[model samples]
Target: MRIATGDDPFVVEILPETPSTNAVLAQRARQGAPEGLVVVTEHQTAGRGRLDRTWETPLHSALTFSVLLRPPAEQVPAERWPWLPLLAGLAVTTALREEGYAAGVKWPNDVLVAGADGDRKVCGILVERIEAATGSTSGPGPAAVVGIGINTSLTAEELPVPTATSLAIESGGLVDRTAVLRHVLRVLFEHYADWVADSESLRPAYVRASATLGREVRAELPGGGTLVGTATAVDATGRLVVTTPQGDRVVGAGDVVHLRPAR
Candidate 1:
């Protein structure tokens, strides 16, 4: 597929290959890239996730991009940083639904779709912050990069897991990757602007699109332990509230797997 170009509002840069769109954009932001600068690459050699997990993508088969946003100084609280990924997931789901697929968010960042027997992950989001060089921080510095990856036309054979799916697979045919990417960006910008104005309104849409709440899930924590619980709710700051065997616990980060009730 040929890389297309347009004189859009945001500075959209398309490349054939990059180590990772997030890393590249972060570097540019450190050097003062303007807000809303979008970097997209056809292939990512060193794509990474939140915990440095490997993110592989086939050449020209998926949407691998990152958007840079520099919020005003001390405008957003550090605790609410997770909202970036949450909002991005919502945008992806909304874009897919507009393209005629049932899309839902698997808490924190993964975007899932209903497969034949269960839900399958179709997209992943990662948000990263750039610190200042002064060695002392009092407020927001440069910008934050929200990186997104969406499976557009990957066949079943190309999927990393049996339960994972692509837009093409879910929609019964090939999907236009460019169209999907453009729509997602548009939705993200609109919602992000509203969030900057007033983040409270995003809660309803996020809660409605979330798949973790009201489900039995096993959360894999960062330090080497697991918590099995029923996801009860998502707090205003976007943390998952899980009712566990011991008690109710708030999970800030984890891999959540939905469980099936015993017969």
Candidate 2:
């Protein structure tokens, strides 16, 4: 199906298959691809998620794509770059909720939608930074490849995990993949523009839509320790702030598991 691009900067390229959309975009970024270019594939042979995890889905059962972004460091400070993935999660969650699904963003990258069993993961986001090749200095400084995967038409039995879900499963029927893609991309681009203009303005809305905030959680740190606490907030620099028994701890990178409902 055709992805309509009426007066938008997005140039969508659809491939029947690929190793990974993010990988493709990263290569193009290193070669100086423009912002708003999107690469989509029906199946990912080597899909990747955060924490170097494998993310695979049956052919034609998911919406997988990556968008190239070249946010100028002057317009948006380098320090605020971490907000890209979080803003993306907010964009996806907002789009799904607007489509009539109960959606909220889980910290640092996953989108959760309420299901009969519980809040199951419906989408995953991964942002990768690619610096320009040596002596290139062609266009922008560095580029960011934002990869997003959404479970669209998979059946319950076909789900990758019991805690994962698809749009069709939640809606109890078929879904129009093209329409969903268009809606999500539009929202995502809007958020991207808003973020470039003023990153701080996006924080309140993101906090309100966060499913992890005020919830008891366990954060698995990158270097090997774990922290159990109440996820108080997502700080200005996009780190997860957990209020533990010892005190408040800031986590810059880690996997967060929701241990209890939001308080």
Candidate 3:
């Protein structure tokens, strides 16, 4: 029951249950909580993902947590902040790889593990930027709350969708949730540190760990539109670049579906 943070900058608060760790941490951030405040819950009644999708899982069967970060705008630059979710995906992918799973990022934030049928998502991430309130002691800067959910002990039948999976199913046995959580936090901290030093250095590593690159995809763009093409690269700004027949199009935000390769 002892969760080891090991002298990292993190201050972890483990709750028995909660509605959403992100919500809790965002509220705390607005109340002037320092960076590296982590909120973890054994059960999340209302977890969410990108595009406002809701996810629910059995109690104590997943890793549900959120990290509060207040990266200095002078050091990280506001424009470079879009890469936080992608960086988190890379960190999770690296951590799961060390656990003997073939994990890779599915652009923006989902982490997928290669399966016999295809790649199945084992983790999802959501990052939200909270603006500072007027006259708040937290300063005029913004804070980011990074929420992460990883399916650990769920069985095959318990998966939310056909394309979803759990570490237990992949490993054929129960995996230690605390160990997984520790490893992920360690890697995420290291990745975050490196990114603060050099943001561009993160791009190549993410591309290498990305399952979306070098594949055909359909991106459901915002405002009722779509773009289908081969996913080529993640540009300098962390947007997805796709090569369409008309020309190359860059997607800043959208629901991307990996399409089956054309014959």
lDDT of each: 0.80, 0.86, 0.87
lDDT value, residue 156 of candidate 2: 90
Off by over 4 Å in 2: 1-4, 254-263
Ranking of all candidate structures by their TM-score, best first: 2, 3, 1
Worst 10 residues of 2 by lDDT: 254-263
Write down the TM-score of every candidate: 0.89, 0.94, 0.93
Candidate 2 residues 1-59, lDDT tens each?
33548898788989899999999889888887789889999898789987678867998
lDDT of 3 by residue, 1-263 (tens): 22446698787889998889999989988888888888999999999877678877899899999999888888988999899999999999999998899999988778999978899999999999988876767464799999999999998788898888999999999889878988998899899999998989889899999999999887765565677889899998889888999999887754444333332
Report the poorest 10 consecutive residues by lDDT, candidate 3.
Answer: 254-263
TM accuracy, model 1: 0.89
- Candidate 3 residue spans exceeding 4 A from truth: 1-4, 137-140, 254-263
Per lDDT, what order, best first? 3, 2, 1
Which of candidates 1 and 3 reaches a greater TM-score?
3
